[model samples]
Target: MSNIIGIGGSIHDFASCLLIDKQMNAIEDERITRVRHAINSSNPCQPSLQYCLNWAGLQLEDIDTIIANDDLLQVIDPHVYPDIVLVNHHLTHAYSTFFTSPFEEAAILVLDGAGSKLSGTNGDIRETTTYAYGNKNDVTVINRVFGDLKGKNYVTKSETLMSNSIGEFYRAIAENLELGWLVGPGKVMGLSSYGASFGDDRFISEMMSCIKLLPEGQFKININGEKGLIDKFFQIRQNYHKKEDPFRIDAAIAHAGQVVLEKVLFHTLDYLSTKIQTKNLCLAGGVALNSLVNGKIPFLTKFKNVHVFFAPGDSGTAIGASIWGYLNNSNQTDDLIRFHSGPFLGRPYSSDEIVTALNSIGLTYTQPVDLYHQVAHLLSRGRTVAWYQGSSEFGPRALGNRSILADPRNSLMRDHINSNIKHREWFRPLAPAVLDSTTAVYFDAHCLSHWMQFVWHVRKKFHKILPSITHVDGGARVQSVSKDENPSFYTLLENFQQITGIPILLNTSFNIKGEPIVETPYEAIHAFLESQIDVLVLGEFLVVKKFDLTFKSPI
Candidate 1:
């Protein structure tokens, strides 16, 4: 009966979402533009708003309310506006995750680069108790109530403002690396896995030097600036006589430092749960994407349940913002809606578009009903194919809907994909998209990651067989695919398995080096033609790129 639109901007990712009667219809962003977190300068929400409206079979005028995330409204275009409702970034993150999680009550920990303030000297460490309504008829729905973890009894703080944040710490580190603030944090995460822990003395000294642990809380020095935080970190590395490998001892120390930060947060939350007598927690924000840190929560916290939003990063804020708007304006608390799996809520391609692209590229392909079998045939022959079908994905990973597929059975395929297709860091590992049913056979069930989120030890029996996708540490970041979530991808894996007896495929983003993941058929085709990829599957049509095997190495 109602249509709500949510928009988030002026942050790292400009995103928008449409919720029809509390059901997510579509979600997308400006990153498809390849600007790397482009801010909406003019009518920032215009593109996404329009797209969402179209997808929902509605118009802007048909929207009942608009939700704006964080303090985006202050910077966004005022003229092109909807009846607005505003929500803090962290709370929005919590909402997005808790609402979607299978648990009715779970411990939520939302960590991000920066969001609207909650409370404390450093806003990064605000603890709160939130109760969500499951049924539309239920009336008691408080998004969050701030809580304190001083001694034994957790006291609710009505008026306390602070700004010390975990998000800033990571951002500062990314800036210090000269890897582009918003961009290189993941690289830092990967580099950290290679280093040794900073242990007690060194870790404590570094913490005291960089952050001041005050009576109320901690505060990090304002070290993030134009010169970048990574450069400053390198200077500190020089003082310690560190090596050139970004993955060296110093890098490991830094990674260990992050672990310490998470520990502090864990202790604070533990103390809080005892005082509040709540067994559930909800998490959101960019840092929630840190699967390693997330994996530690079940072991460290007393909370019985932990839930993180799928799109914990800024992109999800758009959905949060809109939901907040509807709740506040309507003054009605409704049942939390579940988000559909796969971020393929963006624009879809028409058969006409697919055919035009294939014809223009001057490539030969067949439109077989068994699309999966044909594509699998290409992979069985050691060919790499860019697969772009249905709607583009919403997050950083190419979750099958928009991905480059290669044979995981070939040990050298990782290098081929990285060098010729992705053109990313050689040290960086590729992910394997494995059939859900076969996941336990290849990886530890503890490593049964669904979103390419966590690293797991690959079974020794399959390590050499899938060396290209497996890491040197005997680990692989696997994305478990189910036919229900993504039928096309699942069927493709099944077909590939039938041909090669391997359920996993070398899956990487469908883009070249330094490019945003392919958003449209044109971008997908262009990348396929320019790169060494053997074929391009755009919807029903499959276009093969005929090229001589003779090629010089670019890496």
Candidate 2:
């Protein structure tokens, strides 16, 4: 009954979502521009907006309403479209997770660096933490914590605004190590496990003093105290040739931060459950991306069900905006509709396009009769395959559609992929895509991490068998693949299981370090050639690259 486009994001992760009646399509601007986080504030949202429109086969005029977060005004002028509906940033985030979730009613928690400017008695404040409850179509805010950081400009203000942010606290630790804020949190998360061996507990304890945990899950930061600690122990000096070792002070700091983050999240969720009294909980915003903390929520919190969609960061705000528009303007008072069918909302490429890209690249490919079995055979033999299929996923993860697959049974596979394929820090861990039925058999958690949002412990018996996917802490970010959600990926896993008595594969994003996941066939082919990937599966056509087995050094 309605056609709406929802735009969300601030200076980074700019994205757009199109909702025509109940159907939806979304894309992130960084995927199109090939820039991580779409770093430029001046960069228009046209690319992402246009992609949604094109995917829906509609024009701008066809949309009945345009919904966007108030922060997006920095990118697009609201005056140009005077009727555009602008919603608060944290509210949009709440809408994104609660609506797509299967829960009819659930508690929503939004944690980010900062949200839209909020009214404050002292001065304007930014929202860093929010608690809300969504019942049917109605979502009501229960509580919110505002950031006290103040300045004239956005950049200067955001730094202080995030002082009370757990995500910011984690990122600050990573930035202190020169890993940068964008990808640093994950890198630090991986490095934290190494701390127990080479960590400094005194330093970690001193760092913990910078935070004061208040009642009801709120935290007040002693920024001055934290800065003094950082200046004394974390400052990098000039003429430093090599990066710090992961087993030294860096690991200790990461470990301490990781523990603190878990404590903060658990403390907050414990209080939220008391107020909402709901069996279901929904999480959004940047802080929700920490799978290690997320994995432990079910056991730690009163909530029986935890739902985190594929795209939970700022990019997901677009989906939330669209949901808000439909609920408010479509003449339905209490309609709760789930519009997502997994994270495969991006546009899909046709076989013709795949053929053309391969031809143009002057690479010979074979149209395999049974693509799944052939790829399974290669993977079982210790070959790395870049698997490209259907529409790309809409999140930071690669969910099989755009993934690098290898045998998890190979202990050396982790090192090989990190060094040769991803070109990332060795400390980073790879994830696993396992059959849905066999997930409980291999992992020790009860939550459904189908979107790879939570980390689960690998069973003790299987730890040595699946070393490539297992992290240093004996945990693996597991993606439970169901036949209904994705048949092709499921069939491939089934085939791999039949060939080798294992139902798991080491899965990582299909792109190298510092690159957005490959969007087009040409980009995929280019990445396939640039790296030491053994095989490339583009649709049904298979392209093989002759590479030496010495690189793998099979164990």
Give the alpha-carbon lDDT of every model: 0.65, 0.82
lDDT of 1 by residue, 1-555 (tens): 677788875445777888776666545555445665664445565666777787677867888887777547556765567557666666676666665666544545565555554545453444332334332322233333332212211122111222244555665555455445676667666555554332323443454354443322223432332222333455666656554454454465556556655655665465456444555656677777766566556556666466555577877878767666556555444454445444676878899988887778776778988888988987877788889888888777888988988887776788777676677766567889999988889986453457776666688988778878777656677788988888889999999889888888989888887677878777887888778888888888877766554542121
Q: Lowest summed lDDT over 10 consecutive residues: which window, candidate 1?
A: 152-161
Task: Supply the global lDDT for candidate 2.
Answer: 0.82
- Tens-digit lDDT track for model 2 on 188-288? 88888777445445456666777778887687644323343234235431112245543566777778778877777777898899899888999999888
Best by lDDT: 2
**So what's the TM-score on candidate 1?**
0.82
